[model samples]
Target: MFIPVEAPTAFQSFTLVMPAVAVGNVGQLAVDLIVSALNMQRVGYIHTDCLIPMIGSNPYATSAETAGELHTAAEVYMAAEMKLAVLQIRSPIIQSKSRKFRNLLVSWIKASEFSRTVVLSSSHGYQRDDQQLKGIPLRYLVTPALQVSGDTFKELGWIEMERTPPLPGLTDPSTEPRLSIPGGGITKGLFLDSCDAGLSLAVVLVFCSEGDNVPDAFTLVNSLNSWLHLVDNKGSQIWKIPTSWGLLFGSGIPPAIF
Candidate 1:
């Protein structure tokens, strides 16, 4: 149930930033970073039964007068001139409808004809195979359809994600072996779906332990920026935190008790 305030015609030929609901909510938080960093405009929302019910004050609203305006579960933002679109999902995908949601998303993506899609996600730190323990905290997955983008990363010598160990008897057709992502929710499914459907897709994610992951979110966004070139590097900061984040922990506690 994707609805468009700007109309579907506008999304044709654009690149997309999408995220899955994964461990530490890293993907969703990275979406927030992208939305804040680009100052993108809200183009629409997805009205679907596939996600948990959620409603809150607009996280991207900048002014006091509109800061508390109500918003929905999934929002669409766009940097139209840049041919960039971001799908920021704020709630968990309902277990039963997850497959349907993925299918519908892929269908919309194909219909819209986006040139590429980058998924920002994360996995449980403990789930990492020994190889993931070293190097940068992040890893990337590139499907054949994403060879061009993958090439750019390869040029940078970025580490490709390690394939999940195959279960003793499980068989996937590939002779090279299939990859698995244990802690990522829709990440593996969506990426595979997009690839099989011939939609160019890539996944950029990290392994992180659970807890306050705001820092992880920033790091992940910066990593994605390295390739997407979404932020200007001239500045000391890659991106600024959204004004809403100032309220994330709420006003400070009174010191009188201390």
Candidate 2:
């Protein structure tokens, strides 16, 4: 579930939220990806409409009644006609605002059979109400370690290996080097890719706001300038609109025209 954290430009920045549910292989995979990418330890767990060991259901159990209910609820929250949907999933185990969902999720992970997961989020436009505190964006929740490990297993053909390999012999084993006891170095590449994805998401937001018009380029340039201006002023900012002083002074133009 690679949910790109982006908002098209037609609207002002607003909060985007989603209910975590158990849909199927795809749903679980997405949930795992986000959790791993953000290194999220203990996010809260919803009583996901689907059954799982975490919910006290038989680990091997299958129930259509439960799965359908969860799907219906998700549909209600994501109606196609609405520009945005706010759906709520039922979770009997959790019922508190102060309770950090992330913490709870960590405990669940420790107890679960699932070995790996990933989560990705962005902190764009996020803020904290308390003067001394700061808001952390969605990106803060990803689990980098797992993502890196998964990539390592994929590239080295180790995920299905029978056992660990022995140290290489002094005499070269065939023309190539034996599998190094330590895995190959792909860490830096993985981290750079992840951060690149985040920045790309931010840029997409800006592009989406501008539409398909020749003048949209100028509009985008101005919007970026405005954003920079706001940063320079420490939040003090104003929109830059096209205006002609002569049109007002030369014609003795009406106030409405001006």
Candidate 3:
């Protein structure tokens, strides 16, 4: 309801905590879009399998030339609450009996001095303008897991909204921003643009754990300057979607499949 008249100007590195499930690929998409928007360097990409104990499994985790690659990703994920945000994207079928497992996972992620976190799910391919969201603010848009049957982890409330797919005819920002990337391949990016109105607008993907579904709506604060609203074609909330990683070679051509 409150839209900014101008953009903000304070730039801060934001970490994105996403599920390590297939849906997590959604997270990659979201990050890629953000990197292009903000023109900032890609932080890091953490592959968290569980949160109860807060463990990161970079399956392909390897040493970088400067180690800054992995460090940046870890830093951003912890930026919200200085800890990791728990996402239930582990499996598509919530087993309904995984209540205990889910609790442990949430507790473990919370144990760490969490700065703040926002939990999101993957899209059902049902693209719409906007949807309704309800919940109290915690730190960074952390909310209840959607798409899950019944109310299992309702304790961790979250907001909801409509889904927004990537727009058509968008530009590829792998090198234009010209930051630095450690890991190669089709990596996604996150873009946080500060507007002149003391407000910030983030165009990012809602990366969820494997089974976690994309959230209908969520809120973001601490814009480079202030706060701003990012709407979709129907004037709904708009988030950055990671398209793909760059080749780092080959004329830096545009990707075929996003």
Candidate 4:
């Protein structure tokens, strides 16, 4: 992986936000909203052999002259004044390299001395039990170091994801508590890793269906806003969607085709 700029010093003490490519692509889309809303500038990118290679026009670019600038599989953006940085990963990590990539990320976060990190992720809507389906589709988990940041979560009456109890006769041989997140890709692993390593990490995720997950992204980001106060709740401000979103799914089939 590549850290092109002077990332360590530039984002010291910053709170980094990243999304796992989980179900419905919720995390990735939510991060897109954050990057566009904050107008965050790209400082560098993480180029890893483990991720599916991808390249596209810069989604956060506003000016015509630079609209075609390249965006990589993973890019870093920052609002230095606020000590907040975002690492948006647009590609899926290969299964064999997932653990290595997670270790690499944790190392960078440690070496960079980031004050905290927030991971936006999602799980399959179909798997939620009745209890999980009763409230808002959101749930969160916080590392010990992130307790202070979770105050708003408590105030908001959000649920913390429950550990799936082992079946009466089908328990695993391991004794440690299990955190199962079906369809969440590597989210549980990453969060658990951070917790084990004593990093100030918070994971916020939603249970969502597959189609049109845009609303889920908004809800997730707003949940984050409640904690980070990234934007005032006042009506004076509004979340602006990026112009590049117009091409998200590409042009649809011609009406005549049907």
Per lDDT, the best of the predicted structures is 4
Q: Candidate 1: lDDT of 154? A: 67
**Candidate 2 lDDT tens digits, 1-258:** 012124322211211122232211112222222222222222223343232223222111135453332121111122122222222222322334213343333333333322332221111122211221222111112223333323443342222111112432334444543221111122122223434433111110111111222232233333323322211324343222212212322576479976
Model 4 misplaced stretches (Cα beyond 4 Å): 5-9, 149-151, 168-177, 255-258
lDDT of each: 0.84, 0.25, 0.28, 0.85
Which stretches in model 3 have alpha-carbon errors above 4 Å?
1-16, 19-24, 31-64, 67-101, 113-115, 126-244, 247-258
The TM-scores of all predictions, comma-separated, are: 0.89, 0.22, 0.30, 0.91
Show pairs that collide, candidate 4. Answer: none
TM-score, cand. 4 = 0.91
Task: Give the top-scoring candidate (TM-score).
Answer: 4
Runs off by more than 4 Å, candidate 2: 1-45, 48-100, 125-258
Score candidate 3 by TM-score against the native: 0.30
Range of the 10 consecutive residues with the lowest summed lDDT in candidate 3: 184-193
Better of 3 and 4 by TM-score: 4
lDDT pick, better of 1 and 3: 1
Tens digits of lDDT, candidate 1, 121-219: 988898666667788888888778765733687676578888754653445666455577778998999988987998888899888988888989988
Candidate scoring better on lDDT of 1 and 2 = 1
